[model samples]
Target: MSEKDQEVKDQELEEEVAELKDLEEQESVTDELTELTTKIDELDDQLLRARAEIANITNRNRNERELLQRYRSQDLAKKLLPAIDNLERAMATEVTDDQGMNLKKGVEMTLASLQQALKEEGIEEIPAAGETFDPNFHQGVQTVEASDDVPANTIVQVLQKGYKLHDRVLRPSMVVVAQ
Candidate 1:
């Protein structure tokens, strides 16, 4: 081959090689960019998930604190129930003379005040007499035959009063049930 022709062929081959290298470098750069973009997307998704989890935890803690605050007086109210019952029993006693009548009047006032205080604290008496008996709130110690006036599962009488604090029962009512 002639020298000039050989030189020209060599130059053409070098230019082609350079073009291939440029194309490969561009492809590598594009692949690297796509990988970086995918990594960033994954990191963003993880960040969002972590934020949602933190929000859920915060909400749960708030709800728990509210419940605790709402029922804070449960233990003390439960302890006071027997004292109120005693006062009620005292009120029920017969008084013959002036001193006895005065004492009974005082007992009635005390019982009323105690009940008011309990009501203010969200403690309340459970309704049992003449209502449908619920095992959750009433304990049937005795059973009587069902009559036309009182159906089965009805509470005939409450022997001892039941009390509750908010939605939670502090004590169940001891009752007689018609069966």
Candidate 2:
């Protein structure tokens, strides 16, 4: 072939590739469109795969951002524990019916407000009463002999409460169980 014919063929091939790329994007190239479109569909399949890969990467990045946002407060809250411990100790010792009804009322109100604040942040006490025993949620410190009504391996008493954050265990409840 003449050099001019070769140049024309190259231009035609380039145009064909560009057309295929466009068809692939619209997903309109198929066996029914034409034989050339069938080959375009093969290229389209690869294009589809590449697009899907990019979409997956975008979704993964979004998920990571959401997870970071969710756990952002964990570090700050860890630092505040000692003050909370002191407050609880003081509250426990200060409780009395002799401090006058107003003092008792004030303390109860303070405790309720504190609990409400924690609840808003997704901190909740693990259920301990009248539920089936679970080693995962409960730390069994002791086992007591059981009667027929309670059943063997059932929870009898809760020594301390546990907590969860978004389906993850922050702590396990300490309990006594029937065995």
Candidate 3:
């Protein structure tokens, strides 16, 4: 071949190599863009999850606050239960004289007022006598033999009355159970 033809062939080979290099660079840039887009999508998904978790936490805290507020008087009402029982016992006593009768009447009025107040605040007596013995609401202080009339795990008598505030037990009933 002549020198001029050889030079032309060399120039063609160089142009082809340059074109291939440009194509490779473009492919690399496209691959980089795809990877960056995938990373951005993952981050956006994480941000959405974070926001959802924050919302859940906020809702849970609000519910807890409302429950706390609703049961606010539970502690004080529980402490007053023993005093109420004593007053009830006092009411059961027989009085003869005018002074004794007057005092008894006063005691009855006080007891009635206390019960009304407790009822308004959602404090209530736990059903014990004639009910089946439930360990959740009744504490068995003594157990009696089961008779034909009374089944096993039945509450025969409530030794000390139990009380509750809403669905929560302020105090479990002390009771005698047939077992």
Candidate 2 — which residues are off by over 4 angstroms? 1-50, 71-106
Q: Rank the candidates by lDDT, best first.
A: 3, 1, 2
TM-score of each: 0.84, 0.58, 0.82
Per-residue lDDT of 61 in model 2: 96
Worst 10 residues of 1 by lDDT: 85-94
How many residue pairs collide in each prediction? 0, 0, 0
The best-first sequence of candidates by TM-score reads: 1, 3, 2
Best TM-score among the predictions, by candidate number: 1
| Per-residue lDDT of model 1, residues 11-120, tens digit only | 99999999999999999999999999999999999999999999999999999999999999998888898899899888879989999999998998899899999999
Give the Å error, residue 53, model 3.
Answer: 0.7
> Could you tell me the lDDT of residue 44 within candidate 3?
100
Candidates 1 and 3 compared by TM-score, better number: 1
TM-score between candidate 1 and the true structure: 0.84
| Candidate 1 clashing pairs, residues 3+ apart or interchain | none
Residue 107, model 2: lDDT of: 63
